[model samples]
Target: MKGLALFAVAFTGALLLYATGDFPDWGSLDSPANGGELSTHYIKEVRKETEVPNIVTAVLADYRGFDTMFETVVVFVAGIAIIAVLRDFGNGSRGYPPALANNLPEEPDLIVTQTCNLVIPVLQIFALYVLAHGHHSPGGGFQGGVMLGASYILIALANGVEAAMKILSERKILLMAATGILIYSGTGLVCLLLGENFLDYHVLSRILPTDPIMARSHAMLFVETGVAFTVTAVMFSIYANLATRGTLKGGL
Candidate 1:
């Protein structure tokens, strides 16, 4: 009763807040966000510094890359936490059947299975394309990685957890996550070795004869790849644990 009353009050407050004009208009070209203080400066400075056609990608990868690095680490840590909590503590046997262990339905719909079979491959390809072309577009490492992980989930649902796990073994997922972090952090450390600030791409250009803009673009690509790898592995690890109901099934 008290909880229900609280929920009602909270819902009412949310409705009131929505009534206020606090949210920005969708895609308003003349609005301050599109033409105002921050956008004005970003438009002027981003092209001059990064020479990338996609302003959002440039901001995320170059201007505020340190923040992006920490965000990636956060996702990695969340994966580790889920794995630790959900790992089977029992005997060596595949812990439990998916339906019995997870309290999930034994059978899924045919439509879902057929749709997943059709869509998963396309999603995988799209994720890779997004990661590869992030510098020239709105899509980037985080979005691409999530999409990749979603593709794996679709496969797991369409086929089975055991089948998905066979393809993406636990050992491989751990190695991929670790490697992603290492690649990102190692790049920064390499910059430090070259007598520049960590993640400094200007120093990279000195060694490669590429222009500064190109150097930065290359660095962003490397970092994005690392992020995509970690995110994809971590998300799959999470789905595996949940689908198996915290059981360490040898297959899934």
Candidate 2:
């Protein structure tokens, strides 16, 4: 086993080193990507088209909205998959935490619990800031969602998974996950209803009385909100399941 692991690590390193030969030198202006027509197009037109200064955000939430919507669905599906496997569904409890393996209840750490009480609100605040500021800066739905998930995990670590569940029940988590995906795909459906291609943000202009371009930008923000909801719920769901080994009663 150790020998095979060593061989795998060495092979991976060798492959990475060999692949570096095709990569451009550090910050090389003449790199194929820098000079590519696609890159040039995005550089010149993305800001004007999306009205979002952050090029990556514009590309992800606008240019690739359909792809990103499905990507969010993937994240949602993953959470559901884990819940399906770990949750006890034999009885009426479809998604609730399973029973404890033993009778020994976990005691909370006073210091950790008190500190988390102080820190969780701050983390949640930062998460919302990141979600809302993605178009203007270097934060977005996935990043913000992870931060929110971390807050819940901190609570789980400080108190217990059951305590975290009390704050957000299993049903609520599932609801949030589904709701996020709904918001994403629903936006595209709405565009289709307005006589445009799926996810064509300009079609929203028929309803909003704004310029098509600006409407696209605003649509990106709504899409990002959906992403945030699903990502946050899924992250917490996975952690809760793994930390408590499906029971979600106790944790470190």
Candidate 3:
């Protein structure tokens, strides 16, 4: 059995390496992607079709929305998996390993805590700005969510996990994560209900106070906001669980 498995792995690796031989040369102008009408159409017509200035954002939130939505789902699932694997619901202290048990200080450091306090608010505000302006700028939902989650993590590191939990409780984290996916799916569902294909943002023009092109841009922002919500919640939740060994109490 072991020899058969090894042979299978070797065969698969050889097959993949052989397949790569057919790939186009680096930066070849006649490459399928470079020579195709697809890239040309996206570059020339994306702004006119969606009114989203950032071509990448337009492609992610409008052209390839289903793929992006599933990517967010994958992130949420990973967070949930960590919680499932590590969380301990039973009452009372399970006791920490020797490395962690004696390391906690009696009190948080004054300078570190104060610095985090000063920085956290500003960090969170910038995160929101990134989420809102993603269609026009380089920043977006994933980047903003990471920043928001990092602020909570900074609180945990400076003052301990308990302080961070006060702001984002375990229940709140789960709710926020689920809500983000709901917001993304619900937008697509709205489009479907309006007699259009899923994620067809142009259909939103009927309800929104805008034309079709602007509606696509607006819908992209909405989905990006949803992505931000889930990412922010899941980011903090994963940290809180790991730091406290899933008890969500009394850890840095």
Candidate 4:
């Protein structure tokens, strides 16, 4: 029976890998991706409609904003899961102290540390720039949010997880994650209440007639900011938990 199960598993894995043969070639410039109906339509219409140079950004933030909203929720849920699993560990009395205080050797080399320190600030600034210019370019909430998370991870790797957690407290991270979900959901609900489709920014403009586009832009910005904040915090929290072999004391 065990041999049969193993054979079945291997067969299934091989079959799944074989299925990829039907997929588009890895990077064919003339492939369907470059000339398909959907891609062609987006290529033509995206710039005209969203006025964004980055079609991917326009699609994620505007054309398919609803999908992005749900993606943010997924990230938020993952954060919550990490927090719940580790909450007990942060009993206020037991946790790994900061590396510097713990007297761990300063990571055995300074070059990587110095390089990361210099690059991290620039990366963070670029991440924010990407978020802000998403309306005009190829970056947006999801990409920007992940970049933000990466920035913190770089910091944690440089200084230490404890330092990262100090900069962003676990309690605060939990609250922010919850807040991001709430804000995304609440925006949709508010639109529904206003008699427009859920997340209809046009309807929101009626309340602020003088600056409808601005209002829409602001709402999107806020939503993205929430996403970035939650993602960055949650990622660090995960790193802290994993690095310590799930022995860290702080609650998720």
RMSD of each: 4.6, 4.1, 3.2, 5.3
C-alpha-based local distance difference test score of model 1: 0.82
lDDT of 2 by residue, 13-130 (tens): 9999999998999999889989888888888998778888888888888788888988998999999899778766667544544476456545666787899999999999999999
Q: Candidate 3 on 131-221: residue-level lDDT in tens?
A: 8999889888889989999988998899888988998998899999999999999999999999999999999999999999899999999
TM-score of 2: 0.87
- Ordered by TM-score, highest first, the candidates read 3, 2, 1, 4
For residues 39-137, write the lDDT of model 4, one tens digit per residue.
888889865554456677656655577888888888878867875675565557566555544455645258867888899889989999988887776
In model 2, the runs with Cα more than 4 Å from the true position are 1-19, 88-105
Compute each candidate's TM-score over C-alphas: 0.79, 0.87, 0.87, 0.71
**Which is the leading candidate under lDDT?**
3
lDDT of each: 0.82, 0.87, 0.91, 0.71
What is residue 144's positional error in candidate 1, in angstroms?
Answer: 1.0
lDDT of 1 at 47: 78
lDDT of each residue in 9-79, candidate 1, tens digit only? 99999999888676667777887667788778777887777788888988887778889888989989999
CA deviation > 4 Å runs, candidate 1: 1-39, 90-118, 248-252
Q: C-alpha displacement of 193 in model 3, angstroms?
A: 1.0
Worst 10 residues of 3 by lDDT: 89-98
